[model samples]
Target: MLDLHTHVVPAGIPFAASLAADDPRWARLERGTTTGDVLVAGKVFRTVPRVAWDLHHRRESVEAEGGTGQLLSAMPELLASWAPARQGLDFARAFNDWLADELPGHDGFFTGLGVVPLADPEAAAAELGQIAAAGLSGVELPANPPTAPLHAPEWSGFLDEAERLGLLVFLHAVGSPAAQWFPQPMAANGVLFPNSIGEGVAGLIATGALARRPRLRILASHGGGSLPAQLARLDFLRDITPPLQELMPEPATVSARRVWFDPLLFDTGLLSHLVTTVGADRIVLGTDYPFMPVDPVAVLDDPALPAGLADAVRHTNPGALIATLRSHVQQRS
Candidate 1:
């Protein structure tokens, strides 16, 4: 299986630590006597097995389940975009370096996405070249960032730069403040992570940001989150709302077709509905490796999926990111 949506926390933190009494901020992995814990802001983030960083163990675990290879991402907590701009950018660059060193894995089987510091939009935009030069294919972006809204002018450079570099973008849910506006700053996801991807991606489309980044290949993680279910309502509103009608060149459903999604919604019926909405060709496979207990492949390979479509997602549809990684590795060889 070419499991694309997997994560890892390096067993070490090469950077210095900030252990303050009143203010604590840092992201690292602490290896316990037996297991390891991912720590963000000096708090225990996730207690993970060696599979989180042990390359041999990770490969063995996947092979035992008949998986051929896995793409890797740094754990979300490591993104640390909530930190100050320079601090966040430092973490992202360091993490990208660490992740790139692990790639072309054990004979070209492993590839991964680097993380960026959205708090510093310009720096994040500038780091894409370093990420690519380091042998990474793309970067994972937080769906909602504490900076200016993704559709704001500041973010256009970043999005356009990613497109120009042919970088793949995977937007993962991260509940965040809608913007830096204080006193009455709105929260993007009132319920935190659950509603983030939907509101974030939908806002981009409604505000015409996605349209601006016409060539940027973005994947809406977690089955486009809640966006897929709200397409009909958005389309209806667009048809009636004069401003939205003028802003959106296409209906919300058609606009959504430009984005890619994975079938990790955790429901068979919902998966079928996603296929009906987005078409099978736009779907990709992701197992979220070392996190889920059961075989994540079972979701994509479920008998309930349309005939032969599941096979297409598994064998043929590795998506732009993996395909780019393959080309990068080939060039190096």
Candidate 2:
């Protein structure tokens, strides 16, 4: 399986110290804590130290689990989105440089998606160009900024550049301040479900980002963040709402299909629904590895899926996507 949503950390990232920083977002909001030998979010994550990006270790882990290769990128926490644009850009460059330097010539077992600073578009565009030249496969950005949606005019230039360069844009969910919605309190001290994957998708669609970057190959993490369930509502609004009709004249499913989704939804029911709604061609395999050890085989082995669908999700689709950026690198060389 291609495993499109696994995360890796740059060697330069301070794994332990970054937890104790004064940033309230990482402190109060996410509440990082050490447990036995792993780190668990006060709310949603439980991860081991080994998961932090050792290619040898990852290869062994995947081989043990019966998978073939991993498509790796920096985790949302590693991106440090709460930091200022300049700092975020620096972190991105350092992370991407480390990936380029380390992952090649390792039996082609590892591939990478570069990180870009969405907080500043011009700088991000330049960084995107640099990453493309460096032979990275794609660029990663947050699903939405804490303060604003990605479609805000300030970020359109970066989207434009990514499309022009034929770079795949990957959007991962990051920490948010609003988290008081879950019925049961899973964590002793932090918020839960303030705004979820669904809300992020709504924000992206409402902002007209898909319309703006028509040809950009964009993938949304965590199964497009609650989008499969909300398609009916979006279609209703598009059919009746005059303003929305003007903005998105096509059926809502068309826009939904234009954006691909990774299979990071842990629940089988939800994953199946996402595949049915988006079609098998648009669904890609994503384990969100190291954060959670989702069984790739179990996800693909389900009886609900049609024949050949698993092969597309596991290999063909993502290989094609990565090949797009790889071709750019070949031309540059």
Compare the candidates by lDDT and give the number of the best one: 1
Q: What residue runs in model 2 are displaced by over 4 Å at the alpha carbon?
A: 14-47, 180-195, 294-297
Q: What is the per-residue lDDT of model 1 for residues 186-288, given as tens digits with 9 covering 90 to 100?
A: 2533245547788778888887777766777787777777887688998989888999888887788877877877777878888888888878888878766
| CA lDDT of every candidate | 0.74, 0.69
Clashes of each: 0, 4
Worst ten in a row by lDDT for model 2: 27-36
After superposition, candidate 1 runs with Cα above 4 Å error: 18-23, 176-192, 319-321, 328-333
lDDT of 1 at 7: 84
Worst 10 residues of 1 by lDDT: 181-190
- Model 2, TM vs. native: 0.82
Candidate 1: pairs in clash: none
lDDT of 2 at 311: 86
